[model samples]
Target chain A: MNLISEPGAGALILRVQEERIDAAVAIQFKDRLRELTAGGEGPVILDLSQVTFVDSSGLGAIVGAMKLLAPSRPLELAAMTPNVARVFRLTRMDSVFRIHATAPETALHVRAAG
Target chain B: MCAPPDDAALMPAMAPADCSALRGGDDCFRRNFRAEPLAVRDALRAAVARFARRMGPDDAGTLELTLAEVLNNVVEHAYAGLGAGPIDLTLCHAGGRLHCRIEDHGHPMPRLAAMGRAMPATDVACTDLAEGGWGWALVRSLTEGLAYRREGDRNLLTFEFRPACR
Candidate 1:
């Protein structure tokens, strides 16, 4: 898994390149998140439009990162793939985070409003 | 492939009685393949996904992933180097639940439950992780129930899912 960063309009965009986000790559995914947040960024917009599938391990890593960030920073997901979206919906994680339909839209929301 | 004489003929006494059995029904489905692990994984995922949709979407992700990992294991280890043998998979959905069975003429039944122990200290990296270990860990977490046994040179793995009622 590769995490590429681009300065979105207001938020940092993370592009995930992988076919599946299962145990095989969950750790790397989490580590990248940690590396970014630890750099003292204000907020992040994850562009998951490229991720095709995610398993429990991947879900756990994401949830763990959210808890690690706590009330300090906000992490948002945008443009979920069908299989990835299914995991979020089935686990009810969709309700826990702000989900946008596209990467540009996610950055726009964070930039335009609060 | 031609439809069987009776859809139920594809699955004999081993099938759960609570559901309608068919060779090609959306509820019950079967496919045979030539012991290729990746192909088996695809077939398993497709069949399990169908079963989950027919059964309901509650925890369907878990069921589908579990079935794929389990059947993949069977394809890889069961017939590792054996000549050629058919791998049979049957899936059924009824009673608000989904069930899948995979049978292969591979080696004897393995100690799957015993191997579900937490990953050892040395297995943190991709190289150290054994082939069969992570797959079983996935199975342990995904299914509502599981059973493994050998029937006359055939290794049979049955997985059941009855997610909490919505």
Candidate 2:
């Protein structure tokens, strides 16, 4: 898993480059998200534009990251591909997170609100 | 078309040869999965859906997903560690159920009990999300029935589901 992190407009944007979020890669996925989201870095934007698949195990890791970053910093989803989006929608988790269509727009919104 | 009650009753008692020959008024297709998994998946999906549609439309998506998940395991685990030989696939529909059987000339079938023992909590967060154990879990959740056996050099996995019941 590769994550390219940058501070944009005020929120931290995390671009994910991976094909799947499954049992084999969930641990690496969580650790990288944690590393990027640590120290209360405002609202974090996760760009899953490239992800093709995510299972329940993968979903749990993302939920765990969100819980860990909660109260201190909020986690937001952005630019989800169809397969990854199907997973979230299937699990009824799409309602739990603020999903934006793009990372920069999410960052700009957060910046304007903050 | 409606069959006579006597014929319907005798259907269950028919000889294995007779049953094998019976089409259940449906068509069948078998394919080899040595060349392309995606193409095999697409073809299998269409075939299974065609069978399911004869019963009803409600289960085509579920059947398609379950078949893909199990065949993916066949492709990923069975062929990865072992050499890739032809994976025999058969699709047949009878008695309101669609049966799919996948046979591979790979190692012995995976022990599901051992896999059950190895499953971590679903809530546990792993940094590496793509590795290990989830394939079997997905298969278990998606299919109504599963059976595995090894005869000689072939590992056979059979899965069955009723589209109408779904």
Candidate 3:
């Protein structure tokens, strides 16, 4: 349940260090994210490159985290493993959140190059 | 003959057990666990990973996702209000398909008939997007021959999956 946080381009990039986020840690995951992002301003980029699996509870936890932000801050996802990404795609949560193929640093680089 | 033989003697005698090495048929695995949310994920992941390995990585991943969803439902709804109970799972591979059977004694299946068994609308605005209902939809979309039954005190759910290439 360790999350590495980095600030990038007016956004907080939080990378999950775990390999799987399922029912076991879904509640704790949401609680930790809420605690970390509390009173924080600007968008949050959740980097899921290390996550290989996410179940319904994990997905709900993510959505719950988004709702916790409400109208003020947005939550974006980045660098999802193929398996993790499939859960989002299959559930169609891909449409709800902005997704990036790489971390914000890489995304920022691409934007600068363009 | 005197007293029509003793009651125990009148009963059929147990047959002698054959002692030999049993040949494995279809691959089968079973596990029983307490209906607790925290333990459900780990148990399911390990079991699904073991069986899915035989199919392939892709199918394994799919199986993990679908099974997780179903097991979570059991933990959330089935065990809700009721105290912790035993959740039994059996996985078998035969006829070129993987069959999963889950049994629990917590609660009966809810009114899924009204749910329409269809994927929810994903085209809605971001604000209107749903988080929860997607579980069953994903399970339905990935697996085939999904069925549910309740017999007396137990609830049984069965589903099957073919290989990814199939």
Candidate 4:
């Protein structure tokens, strides 16, 4: 249930470090995303290359994340695995978010900040 | 469980054996677990392993997602008030389609007749976009021959999926 945050030049990126985001962790995922995106001004890009699967509950949590930032900060998706992308595409959330094949060119900010 | 199933996770889930020690024509898997998200996760994992050798990556992914939604529905909705109940999952891969039946002895799934008929209106404002209610839609969109029935005290939901031929 941990997400690695990378500082981006024009956006904020949070990478899910888990394999599956199913019913087991959907609530926590939503809460964590809210916590990370609370004060960020730019679009929050979710790096999902490591996410192997996402069920409907996970999908809902993602939508919740986007709605939480509504009208101001956008929650975008990037680097979706085949299964994870399919869920978003099937639910038509792909059209809602700015999806990137791979997370944009953000230098992987190391933990030297804190 | 309404009917006992030798959990695929526990036993040597190679081939299902019968009274005469005769194997069935198709590979079938049956697992019984507590109707909880974590148990559903474990069951989905076992089911994938059972059929992964015969399935491609895409089909495996589809089946896992579909089953996860169905099984999670049982956990989140079916047994909402009844704590944790037992969920019986039976999956048989035959005729190039994976058949799934999940049984749970919880509250009757309300509005059973109108399930998955329409996709939740995803075309909405960001604030109005639904956070939930997409489970049945995703289940219906990804699978075929979806049906649900409450037999006395148990809810039996059956569905099928045709895996794209590789």
Which candidate leads in TM-score?
4
For model 3, the stretches where C-alpha displacement exceeds 4 angstroms are: A105-114, B1-25
Give one digit per residue, the lDDT tens place, for model 3 in B1-166.
0011122111112222222212234787788988887677767777876665466556777888887888888888888998778899888877667789999997897796722466666565545556677777787889898888899999999999766543
Error of 4 at A5 (Å): 1.4
TM-score of chain A of each: 0.84, 0.86, 0.89, 0.89
For residue A13, give model 2's deviation from the true position in Å: 7.4
Give each model a TM-score. Answer: 0.52, 0.53, 0.83, 0.86
The DockQ-based CAPRI class assigned to model 4 is acceptable
lDDT of 3 by residue, A1-114 (tens): 898777788899888989988888988899899988988899898988789889878888898888787668888888887788778777766666767667777343333454
User: Among these predicted structures, which one has the highest DockQ?
Assistant: 4
- Tens-place lDDT per residue, model 2, B71-165, is 65666666776655677778777665667888887767556684343333333332322233444555565566688888898888888766544
lDDT per residue for candidate 1 within B1-166, as digits (tens), equals 1111221111101122223222233367788886664465467567756655433443455566666566656655787788547888887666555667888899875665553565323213222322224456556666766788889989888877665442
Say which candidate scores most in lDDT: 4
Ranking according to DockQ, highest score first = 4, 3, 1, 2
The residue pairs in collision within model 4 are: none
Which parts of model 1 have CA positions greater than 4 angstroms off?
A1-48, A55-114, B1-26, B55-58, B83-85, B110-115, B119-132
Order of all candidates by TM-score, from best down to worst?
Answer: 4, 3, 2, 1
What does candidate 2 score in Cα RMSD to the true structure? 14.0
List the global CA lDDT of all models: 0.61, 0.61, 0.75, 0.78
Q: Give each prediction's DockQ, rounded to 2 decimals.
A: 0.06, 0.04, 0.14, 0.26
